[model samples]
Target: MIVKNEERSLERCLQSVQGKVGEIIIVDTGSTDQTKEIARRYTDRIYDFEWIGDFSAARNYALEFASSDYILHLDADETLEDPNNELMGNLDKDFYYIRIKNDLGTGLVLTHQFVRLFRNSPEIRYKGALHEQVQLDHNIHQYGYLSTLILHDGYKDDIIKSKQKAQRNEHILLEEIKNNPTAFNYYNLGMQYIVAGQYNDALNALKKSYTLANNYTFSQKVVLEIMKCLHELGRYQEAVKVSMDAVELYENIPDFWYQLGLSYLEWGMLKDAEDSFNKCLEIGEEKSQELLNHYDGTGSYLAQGQLAKVNLMLGNNEQALEYILSAAKAAPNVTGFFNIFLSILPNASPKELLQHVIHIWPYQTERHANLIATLYQQRHPLLNEFITYHNLDVEYPISTLHYIFENNYERALAELNQQSQKGTDHFITNNVILLSFLLNNPNLISEFKNDISLSEKEAKWFKNIILKKVPTQSIHVNKALLMIWKQLILDLIQLQKYEFIDLLISATKQAEFRLIISECLQQYGFDELALEVLIECDNSHVNRQVYMTAAKSLIKLGAAEDALFYLSKAEGVHLDFNVLFEKWRIASTIDKFEEIKILQKMIQSYPESRWAKRTSGAILG
Candidate 1:
């Protein structure tokens, strides 16, 4: 293994393969930490190599001491997931593709096969400076799959933040591109920028790589990255254009269909999205994993999970649940999948929710309990019974939620603040900011907001939400972040945080948005709070459903006059007689004879309609 400052994971990697391998060799380029000390515990063949800013150099130097005939290489951040000396004992190929599962921060995981195990031939030396590859150019390069898995945590958020390898690799790859411009090097640089969230630069580099790609071995992979970067940059049309070309040439690759589906989903073409995702499922898992930089289960569970979203937005809840259940069963540990569960079957009683979750994840590991607990936390009545039944200790965030549920906002805020200082979970940090504002502690709000990670869309949402300023952009939103705000709304209603809730309503501008908050408030018997939302809408009930909802809310609050006024403000949507009849009924009940007579004339416009005739006859009598 070639490593530098990998003390945190060096020992773990060595522990996985210590007894299995014939000999272990660790080459340290330069490490200020206890990496060498840790390496010595497993291998006496540890060598100190001078830092030359090239990974292949260090990797090749490490390989010089490997006495094994068939070599299986690993990095400091990688571990053999199973003690499979039996699997190792049966290697019979010139090279093998090792399955690597990468934890790419958040709940995102990607698994791909790479040429990590190969015969120790001189011609099979490493190539490239930064993103090195096995030199598989020789005629003897016959490769097959190795069943052994390697869990790689090199891209986990904490590790990425501490190591900042993305930045370093970006610089190195750029230099390599200048010196020797290979398609692979540009691809490497594009991937580096992608990890750094520079989607525009990534797209540029990936496009250049596409133009120079003489060999079509990883050409589909290049197209994938370019399309991915385009999607990230919100160039949906361009992404779909590229995706169309890619899927035509590489029709067998499920990822191309998946990418096409994502673009269609983003562009609001739900039918097209449904079609693309179905196509992906039909393609299923196939070969050439080593040729693509992709995720695990793209065609099967991943595609199903995405299909759940499409169906959810399409209002097919039952279909959505089926797809999600399949996905959750496959990867029950992913918390986001459960959130989607909550989004789909939100009305499921708490007991049913628990039972449904237990059905999906029968094993009560911490992962299973956490999924149940997380689902519970999003809704009401903290599930202490379930927690006790599972015999699991609650962790932070969830622990904080208990305090919130118990109406101990002060204690919750204190715990959240302390937790914010230690580490950051975006959800937890968002709650900390939320509680600060809800508690009328604006001073703590700024400090807490900075603790949470923000994507561009999310940053806008936070700024707009915190400022109690209505959003000016598209009403379509970021689902994960929207859930955070949804929780805040629920908290506001639960805790009777009326003033803050009003500010929240006052801050929002979208008609659909105002309607949602108002309707939520209205359903919970907060008509006044609902009014805080409805009163903010433009004086038009014709097109806007919110105005009609507002008029109904006002009637519930015994503001008949105000209700009639809202009902009469009809310009946007058609002035249906149902609305006019509602206004007439209110006017008659409130003893507004003159207003009723005027409404009778206005209702006569639709003379042939039953509602207009009823209004005219009622007024005449």
Candidate 2:
């Protein structure tokens, strides 16, 4: 083995081969520390060589000192895992490829096979200045593989940063490219650039290597690297085209399909992305052992996560949950897997999703608390059960929200009072103000209004409740209050509480809240008030939901032109069935035949529903 400044790892490397190998030969180029001293304890065959930028030259120099019939080479940071007698009994093969598991710092393990053990002969020598390869003079048909595993952690980020290995490799590779000008040199340079996070440089070098590469294996490697560089550069179209070619050329590689899926996802081609990710999973499951060293294993957990994301995009929430659960089981410590699972919760039944989250609460309690609180605010059942099971009665936001949702106003107020004595958190104070308003206690609102630091939405709610006056001008609105007000307005509208609705309308000056008030007015058969509110409101503060609602209100009032204008504002947002049907209805009323066709196509692409089918029939008929 040839090494340089590996004092921390040299002894461990030597110990792994103890009693398993015939002789230990180490060639040290330059080590300022105790690397030589550590080697002296294990082997007496340690030799010194002058520092040159060529790894192959130093490796070849070390090879000359070996006196065994078979030679095994390993780095100072690598160790053999349980070397058995059967592995050493493989004397019939001229060379053997051994599995190397490289631990990448991104919580991933990559496995690849390398020819580490070969017969000792004068005809065989090492080649290349960087990423040195072993070359043999004659064709050896007796090559086989060994089950011996080697664990390597030298490529991890902390180790790489301390050693400055990428910078060193880049310097040697650039010199090699100048002197030798080989495809292998360019490939090594591209890989080094990749390690240095220089995607543009990596792309150029890998492209050059691809053009010069004659070997299929090297060409495939170059293509994958180029695809990675393009993906990182946000060149999704180019990445897709290159990955398609790669998938066609190297159908056995799962990484190509996985990358293609990622590119397609970025390009908003959901169906294509789904197909590619599924293909990756299929190939990965079948060929789990043929993993690449530079890439994470696809079928193990990474592909499962990607498949979960793809399924979520396709609106298959149940399928997404299944894949995510499997991925979480495979990699429970990976936060991304659980994050994807949380994202799919909104698409599922709230109660059922909450139960699932509760089951996995121990894995990530903090994350589960935030997510469960969000769904609980949407009025999902079992909040009390969740609070009791997790012993979250003493927590700030969850406890406060639990009391508010339970309609135990006295208990809720007492919890807020207790929390306020400890210190004031902005979110907790805001919850206290909101609960006070819900309880219809003007005294409580007056008490909390001065001391509580409120967000813009909480400030709006606070002023509206205490002052009982609406601002005549527009202000920046809080989106969370819009949802909260939406639920509250629906309840008030059911009870015919028009006086309280008017007070709400008068208190907040934001156009967004005015839109909500207008909806409440329309529900009470107050069309004139609703239309007046919509006209007085500014369009800048309105969102897609508001625009759609305004358009529907205008359509009901026989103002089709005004309805079309609001519909145009809702174009870029993700359209639900209601929005699409409304757009189609407006188009049909206005005799806009071209828009009818586009809306019909969009409706058909979405899942078939009663509204979708009826809308399609109306447009086509």
Candidate 3:
């Protein structure tokens, strides 16, 4: 057992590995903290090693003091999750290799048991500067990569400190790469850049590593990094091409299939995308088959969620909802499940989705409050009543924004004053709350202007968020209210009603305003006016919704092909009215029959929905 300044994780590691190993040799590499003191409780065979840049040197030095025949190394940050008989039984094996599992999250875990335990011999030494692996002779054989996984929680917070450690190792790896230019070294560098959010640097380094990789062993790792980098850069076309190339190289790897499917989806190749995602499900872990029950079963929350996202992107809301529901069932406590839950209700009331979110993740009240407030301001049906009756803790800055949105200026001001005076640096939160205050009650700014010490840039940033009413500014949105406001804004704008200037001003700043306005114009049965807004926006949320709405209006105008064109552009919004529009277009050709049944079904199912009810009534009439 090797230990250092890991007082944060030492006791947990020791408790897990205790009683299993015969001899414990903890090497303290200059711990300024109480790490060595804690190490004394476990074993007296603690040795001090001076701080050196070489991790291999310190680890190898610890091995010299070990008296056991088979040495099992344990990092202070890593723990043996199941200290059962299977793990204890495996220790007696003569093989140098042992399986390792990384218990990354509480429920969502992946196993990658590497050979960590081995006989203490000169040939078996540690390699690499960072994420070092055990080097063994060619004659040595590996044990099974079993189910016993190590829980690694060291990646928590401390990002700046971690980057500092990586920067030093990156310099050392660069020197090694200069001499040998090995595939592994470059791959490591790319991973480091990826963690650091240096997308361009990661891509360049990964591309170079792919060129240098001569071994199949490192090929999968290379492909994963390249695909991830391309995805981050939004180069979906090239990403899909590269992922296909990887699948051709190694078809068995499940991650490659997952990436291939995701990239194809990103590139809007839906049928091919669905096929790729299904292949990923087929190639899933054999042991995890019971957990996966669907044709697109990803066996994990993330994979299921990804499938839902793809289905949602293709305008298959029912399928998307199915995948997301499966994910929620698999992992009820996860926040990611709510992401898909909220998205599926693109046309649902914000209050409805917010209730669902808070119901699943009850502890996430802050998130719920924000969402509730957003819905209220967007004029989602009865969102104002929901907040007033529910008595949700609106002390938070965003909650105050919602209060202001409802014209409860007194309560909103009170919340802001309390938050601002708390002396806590609420930069982002404060900025958003103040922006709402400015929009709802401009006079309040003059009253609090002396108290608020905002920089020119910060003020400008706040102004942008306030003007755009971008969802980024605040999480709370009333879907119904937003839809209604969107309709009214479009009506007022197209009808040239200057009386709704305040409404237009409030919405003009929001990212989705133009799209909402465009849709309203089309819903009022004005295709040309809606198209004018479509020409301005490039696939933004409201833009896509409006474009789809435009298709319906075009069909009404007896332009069937033009309606189909708009429907094609409504890919990202996940709009479902395209099929209905098509049916209506065909009906228009006959001029004898109306597909009012479809419209009635939609309106009956979603009565509060403007689009559904309007289209349904129009067909009925």
Candidate 4:
């Protein structure tokens, strides 16, 4: 196996392949750490290569360094499972098979396979910079699945390595796109954006790729990326279209069918969604049909597991449940299959389901917080179960806020106060924001005031998002914040809290929010009151609403020419009649009969609307 920067897992990897291969070769590519030192202990023919941007290049270089007729490559982050026994048993097999476990950052494991142990001939070489794959010249013969699996432990921590790598890769792809603009390069750039969590960029690149792609080589990939982007952007209908297009392109690929089913599920297309899921079940069953033909061999249980997943997505809880149980029974020792089985639910009691999940996957504590929320949604009394099973010492403030929203404020308050006693950082401040706005318990502002330390950025974020509803001392709470606070104050007037209005004007200490408060007063039938605030605005930097509000107020005050001046600032005659009413009033006062006729005609066009009635009254009066 070739290796680099593998000091953390090199020993386990080397020991796993021990006695399996006749010859061992270690290819190190520019290791600055103790990786080379540890690798030297395992093999005498340790070779080095200069680091290059292309992954396939490094992999091919490593392949050339190997002396054995067959080559098997493994990453530094992986360990061979039960390597000694499994390797010895499958050494002379006709076809190569490798078990790969995706150790994504969240600690979830998805196992797949690759044909890594292949003949060292020119017919096979690696391709692609990222997600490198071995290109085979001929069809596969007989293949064997090893009982042992590879343990991938790469993504234990949230690392910057992948993002840093993507930053460099995106540049290379940009250059390639300039010259070639191939569907494959765009698809690669899109995938890199996905890896870096840049969903918008991912969508742009993937959409361009999809439009340009005319062939199958990159069609499936382009469709999948576009579907994922639409899903992330909350365009569910668009996502469904992409998924359907993919299903039409590749009718047999179970993944595309499953995605189509999920899109339908999200859009509440229950019957059609279930049919799509059923297609996945049928296709997935056929995927594992070969196992039954070869009685002595293991089949692709992963595909079958996915079939169960699609069924679950379709809400066919019973049928999905059966598939998982049968799959687990077929491969009893596969822990991943058991976990999938535990996830199955029919019309089963919530308590029973939670009990089964916890009983079977007792060691899987990572999902406890999520399961707690899910159980609560199902109206299951699993709070104690969650706290006990997961040892969740941290307060889930957002979850508490949700509870308060459900009229469970007493319970929310209890959790928040308990967390405060524990002195956990950021617990009190976030809870206070939720309590003040969602629970409408202004007392939390005072209760948690001294305890909460709001940073300038955090304060600005809260002011922008949440405090618009509160709109009181939160200004003092987030000073030096420069967002225009006018409309926000106007919203407070609609909320009808006169005390909040006074507090807003006082806190702003500037004329901006006062002008907005004036608009609010006009909306509240206090047009005369609104005019006073408009006068304070300097009439220069105020927004469209400020002029509209001033026009309406001036019309109410019978200052027709002033109203006309303000109404003239409005861009078009097709504006809402609250503003047009002022314009019509001014036109009649000035005896501009033509403009008045046009305004009257507009009112007549929409006679039933409130704006029309106001316009007609202004014109006649």
Top of the candidates by lDDT: 1
TM-score of 1: 0.72
| Residue 365 C-alpha lDDT in model 4 | 47
Candidate 3: 10-residue stretch with minimal lDDT: 287-296
Report the C-alpha lDDT of model 3 over 360-392, residue by residue, as the tens digit: 545445555544544433334335445665675
The runs of at least 3 residues in candidate 4 whose Cα sits more than 4 Å from the true structure, single-residue gaps closed, are 1-4, 7-12, 81-99, 105-113, 121-136, 139-163, 172-186, 199-219, 285-354, 364-381, 389-444, 450-621
Off by over 4 Å in 3: 1-4, 90-111, 156-163, 287-300, 346-409, 421-440, 447-502, 505-513, 516-562, 565-621
TM-score per candidate: 0.72, 0.63, 0.69, 0.53
lDDT of 1 at 44: 90
Tens-digit per-residue lDDT, 1-621, candidate 1 = 887888888888998886677888878887899999998888798899998888889888888888888887898888896555644587777888777989875356777778888888887788889868888854656778767888998887778888877777887898888899988888888888888899988888888988997466666678888889989989887888888888888888788889889987786556567788889789886632644567766777778888999888655889999999999888776677777777786545556777786688677565766665574556444354356556767667676766666668888777786787677344664566566675655455456555765455655555566666666765454456566666677767655666777677667665555666777676566778677765444434423576677787888888888787777764236565446655666766666675566466554643323334455577677
Per-residue lDDT of 1-621 in model 4, one digit per residue for the tens?
556566767887777767766666777777777987787777787887776666778788777777666676777767766635655553665457666665653223444566667766776788766556787534564456565666676643344463245678787678668877777778889978887778999999988887887563456557766777887777777887777767786676666666666666565444445566567667754442222111111223444555566566444557777767665545443445544554463224435655655554454444454454444333233444455455555345545644543457678777777766556544455456544544545556566656665555444444444444433343432232232243334324323346656555444534555665675576446777677665433345455567777876777677878877777676343354445544554675567675567566654643323334454567578
Alpha carbon deviation, residue 477, candidate 4 (Å): 18
Runs of candidate 2 with Cα error greater than 4 angstroms are: 82-86, 137-141, 286-296, 333-335, 346-621
Q: Sort by lDDT, best first: what order? A: 1, 2, 3, 4
Model 2, CA-based lDDT: 0.71
RMSD of each: 11.9, 9.6, 10.4, 15.2
